[model samples]
Target: MENYPTEIQEAVKIMYEMRGNSEGMMTWKNFPLAKQIITLLDSIPNRSEHHTPYDKIFILNFIIDNISSSDTPRFTIEIMEKELALLKEVLPADLEEYNDPLTAEDIEEELQMWRDYIDTEHFSNEEWCRKYSHYMKFDPIERSEIWEEKYYEIESKIDAELMKEDMPRGLGFCFAYWSSKHKVLAEMGIEWQSPQEMNPGVVFD
Candidate 1:
């Protein structure tokens, strides 16, 4: 993989943690896989109030597409296959049939719902905040910006690893577009680069 190891471990962890329990090798295909997975890893909360059934599926697909598994300590290919199958089962027929991708407002609303749910269990929304008491006092925007700065720095590590595959945005928008599709992360104004972070100055943008 060119950037960020391009595996799905993060997705697995996110999905598993979403239920606040462990599904072992289970994954949902109901929504955008990559996005939800990211939310999970990012410790973003869920909000059924903000999304319809279809939006949930979109979220699954989004996270599944973006998270990597290679990051796991002893993950097996069999586990990956099982998770993939489960994901497929949860997916809606013809995701492309829908247009008008979600907006930042949509993400915020959904995330807020998740926040309300987790608040009873997890004190702070941000992962770092939960880890450290100091971060708990920071405003939402401030915490978001802090993470944005960190992600941007990570981006610099793999800025130049573009491979130019048959990306969803056709090629021109492959780099920046894909990166910005992460609404919460995008709000921080950070660019997406390779997850592995090996090359630099080789992005499509």
Candidate 2:
């Protein structure tokens, strides 16, 4: 098996931590089987340079989901091996040959667009408090709705600019994973501000 890339190795380590901390695995007796399956997955060739970490994250989540399904351990290492083999059969021999239309430049552009929009947009005091107040004080569902509305607004702008008929599967997954405003801002190396931080003199009810 090929040595795992640094990012993939890190992802595997995170998966191990998740497995150890999982509440459902307290009495599970299949640590060895889980380890074997994860090791096998760690060796799988990454499908894309930019999407490898996301792919590994997806695989780790799949493993955990399956492992947590039963305390008795429904699947064996051999079964996993067969499944991996079948998966490999459908993969391209040189996955690098496939190019993702969405580049890092594109991501950076979208991130900047989001940042600028957030920085310039004005909201009423009540709406601002609902959107940016601390989680405990304000309704989280309302905050989510505001963020969702903003997210779609930005996404529509991006779609119009790109004008691509179909987004690649891996990029689609990546976008889905980082759907929230905080996550998107973090990706852009920006920190989200609280209501108090953004409006020092303003008081919230």
Candidate 3:
């Protein structure tokens, strides 16, 4: 809360109170989708208040709008596809600037970590999973029938339950929102890539 900017802080403050608590409870859940986003946007540390930069605002707004919206169901496939594209489009591009070849071992480790990424974290979920997959790989078959079914099944369990309108989901997911938050340890200059949990069916090479 202390890290938040003034305007965003104001909005969150109002919303917090509106929901009857600082934690913004709804239906026995933690801060509701609208409140979560309101808190997140409000938390952005910026020069001014609600007037955050375009990219930042765009990112947050995209997340807030969709997550809390009841409209995605109207055209779940189309909306999911579009949101997936938008997420990839907006993801930070700094990772590709790696200094050297990503060796087979490196690939293997990354793949495992990617799989481990499925482990539920603070705020991350399927939406974050799909979006991250989109940005980290090339020509990913995100629209596969399997993915479609998975998305349908997952989305069916959600509706207007996001923290914000449609900014994004998984804000708390191991640094899903902040690119530098819970960085991959190996990539952060701490250690070499390590193998992920062993699975015979999975191969890095």
Order of quality (lDDT) = 2, 1, 3
Residue range with the least summed lDDT across 10 consecutive positions in model 1: 69-78
**lDDT (Cα, 0-100) at 112 in candidate 2:** 37
lDDT of each: 0.37, 0.41, 0.35
| Candidate number with the higher TM-score (1 or 2) | 2
Cand. 3 Cα-lDDT: 0.35
Error of 3 at 194 (Å): 45
Candidate 3 lDDT tens digits, 137-178: 211223233332333333323323233334243434222322
Q: Write the per-residue lDDT of candidate 2 for residues 142-182, one digit (tens) a residue.
A: 23324433443433344443334344434343333223434
User: What value does the lDDT take at residue 41 in candidate 1?
Assistant: 32
TM-score for every candidate vs. truth? 0.19, 0.21, 0.19
